[model samples]
Target chain A: MGEWSNARATSEAAGIGAAGQVQVDDDLALVARVQAGEMAAFDVLTRKYRERIFSIIYNITSNREDAADLTQDAFVRAFTSLSRFKGQSSFFTWLYRIAVNTALSHLKKSRMRRFFSFETINEEMAPGEIVDTLSQKSAGDHSAQLAELQEKLNEALQKLSPKHRTVVVLFEIEGLGHQEIAEIMHTSEGTVRSRLHYAKQQLQADLQSYLS
Target chain B: MKKRRESRHEVSGGVTLEQLLRVKRAERPGPEFWADFDRGLQQKLFKTVVDRRRSGVRNFFRIVLHSRSTYAMPILAAIMVAFGIALNRGSGDGPLPQAVTAPVDMVVSVEANTRASSPGAERFVVDLLNSGGESGNFRKVMSLGSINTPDAGSTRYVADQLGSVTGRGGVLSMGDSF
Candidate 1:
């Protein structure tokens, strides 16, 4: 969060329109610097990729505290394994792999607990503690159209299997290419396409109530 | 392209099927989103560095204390090689250089005990040594010479190899001068 504050301040100064546009070359440069053992370079990379990784974890785990902890663990593992990172894949792809692995390990550990079902967690209530404020803001009024859609979407996402949820998150939310998602998931592109197809069907069925 | 275009259709509800399909491929998150992500990611990175540093320090001392041979062998070999090279550079007495001298004696002595050792190995050694002796590949470049008579089969094979120095290529002959 240290350099994130600075990044945020810089982006804010740059204005919102320019903020979304992170140049791929710049990202690669920063990664090179990170590989060269520059902490500032790593900090920039963390700032750039943190939210996407966090969002993916949050989508699956849906608990703020767990998300935060898992996210930190993910970054830690990524840093330690950075030397082994072959540049065959992009930096984000590598980061995504680390995040997914960390989250899965967390889920595996929690699976022993009675109430530890990942699919049962509410998406809106994810990033667990941090959302309390947001939840309170929407406490009384569940009447808004966008809010209702968001709720429906979140609920439907929770109903997915971990594998399908991952496919959906990467393909739909994260918007990675099918090939890229295939690489991240360590599967064939055909499998990614099939899973994505099935996931979309399931999501559509789950949110059927909202469609009308 | 055609298939994708055909596939792009609005669903029965307000949000199209295309919208759902477009999610991950949809436009990237805004700057505010990234800014938020950065904060959380940095804390995670810092925590990891600290953890690794702690683990690294522990490992460094553990290695120093145990003095494991697995760790020691390569280091020892490297140092020896370096020292050998350095010694050769100054006084010209390196083991590798000495092994490859062309003028060195070609006869490599072998223990005559035949029943004790494996068969054909002597012949193979003889062939190798004889080839080296005559061609001087092993003797001149490798600085190794001499095949011993105790291993008669190998020695004879070496002798045969030494005889073939012209076409078959043997340079080191038995009793050759170093």
Candidate 2:
């Protein structure tokens, strides 16, 4: 993604970027229901976003178990903090902010033994054009080739520092725009772009063999 | 045909970094994982509710800090002010006493030996000044023994810090005050 493209879009539609009207409205209603002593509504919100949140944390941690644990903690924190949610931003944005912070905090606190468990990719996208092209070059079956690519990708991602990895994950993988990520990271849009640039350069260097 | 939307930046190979990294987006866990994830979440939620109940002090303080800050603010300010006052008065903080300070005027006693060396008119003036004797409250500033008078003859001369020998033992003026 071009840095100026995000900057121009954010500038054009400046002021507290609302995600989408219907989704924001639904989230607001659900949040109100949760505030009115309805635990089921919180369950609904949790169910709605748990997969996406888990994916974000999982990409950062490189461990499915740690990602699962941190995801639950993020939800619990959001539920407990529902009263203070004055709908300044969309509930979606707020929840993602909490999840990202929870993951970043866990990474900082624990000098954990690095564990990388390359889980299976989505079956639907496994036959995509990019994977197909790379698979043809490697001398192996589909499963073996996918595994090799995943290991290489994760290794390259892990080489980046946590902040830089977060930028790449949120921008490229999550498809989040600059303004939203800036808000989540509590930083300037320029900083996010810089981190993304640096992170991409580092990934390119690390995966030189695979890219070649 | 999603022609792998090209970015302006790319490697020597055809794959752009964004296009290459987008493959990671498919690393999402399948539906089966949520079965156990939901089960563990329910257990953790129950434990969190119990823990929140147990943390009465934390919630109470949080409420006090958020809602009742108007009242709490004054109390906090008062406590800080009291602490500052106590610290100021602890030690090495008050003014010195008046008696501990040096006096304004200084007096020099003229002995009989000095009078014998002087002429008669000067001797009369000196005698008149010394005649009052040691009647007033005077603090000794220094001894005039360093001057080495020809004959001391049982009379001692000294400088004292007396405000004024107005009607009694008059303080001989020495260039106002030494």
Candidate 3:
């Protein structure tokens, strides 16, 4: 959901520096509630995670339609399989596993690349400093230039192999630490870092026109 | 590779790959997207997940490699024990005890990796949570563990997890509705 977080949520900007324990504990408690036949608890989780689930998938597939569908499927999957979710990993991590696999499966099955449907770039989030420079560089058409840059970025991302793109999305875009991505991807931290490096190198080359 | 070069690019002001990628950060769905998302999820849960209970438990963890890697990973989905197991593993991150007491299986543990075995084989993998992984490169990583649904949709169903069909339910994506 949008802007949907409990009051106990840590500052999203601070990145859960010291309060991670409190958050994870809260997740476990919610997991306990949902396992106890509290459908509403599951709903709480869906609201908490749906946007995230959507974003990861959206970035991976580069197709808004597939991302939206896969996100719902991932949540529904998480809900139905609620009984199996032993709290070994954080619930969000568990949910993420479902989401990534869902996207991979979709990518594997359809193997059909459709027209890319990207989400709108939130104007507020765009770095004004960079936007201003880019605007001047691109003939002062600020919004249009940003939109083009957005498309080019998505295109560059979509060009990566699925695995590389997943790493890039998680590490670069998602801002997850290497160890966390390793655990989520079921790969080693080395692999995460390696994939991230290669993915970035490719992106850097592809978008050199903009970055340079 | 030089450590500094690997980390950042000093192009005058130096726009790191991470910063350039922030453009992707700017791309996010608005509230209307969430409203449709809830509706879609409720509908799919009603359809496919209910139908998957009989497809047989996933006997093996499909640990996809990056076109390069050694060995495999196994997750607990099939052969994942049956019964109403309690998640009373005390509060903390423990490996999920691989037991599926249907209707009420509580997986509470401090271990990060959940274990699952392949029947009639010695191979096992910690691949239970791969169907979808990673917090949506959250526009914001609001680690709100205690979450509540404000007008969350309703459609309850029971069945096995969506292992293969995680991508089957094709809901019409939100178009220009962001």
Estimate, for each residue in B10-64, the C-alpha lDDT of model 3 and write its tens digit: 2214445566687777788888878787767766755644455333233223333
TM-score of chain A of 1: 0.71
Interface RMSD of each: 20.5, 29.4, 8.1
Give the Å error, residue A168, model 3.
Answer: 0.5
Ranking, DockQ, top scorer first: 3, 2, 1
lDDT (tens digit, per residue) of candidate 1 on A70-96: 776777777667667767766777788
lDDT of 3 by residue, A100-212 (tens): 88998899987865667888888778766556566444454566667766876888888899999998877666666677678778998889889988888899888776664
Q: How high is the lDDT of residue A166 in model 1?
A: 87
Comparing chain B with the reference, what is the TM-score for each candidate? 0.25, 0.25, 0.24
Per-residue lDDT of model 2, residues B1-178, tens digit only: 1211211112224556666787787777777788778766765665555565557557765666677557876776676797786556433344323212422222233444344566576775555456443322121222233223321211111122122234335533322211
| Candidate 2 local Cα displacement, residue A57, angstroms | 0.5
Any runs in candidate 1 off by more than 4 Å, and if so which?
A1-24, A112-143, B1-13, B17-47, B68-178
Q: Where does candidate 1 chain B have its weakest 10-residue lDDT segment?
A: B4-13
Local lDDT at A112 for model 2: 64
Query: How far does residue B78 in candidate 1 sit from its true spot (Å)?
Result: 20
lDDT of each: 0.54, 0.65, 0.61
Give the alpha carbon lDDT tens digit for every residue of B1-178 in model 1: 5532322221122444435333222212445644454445544544454555567668865675578667666775676797787556545433444444533333232223223353567765665565445433433423222332222223333334335544445333222200
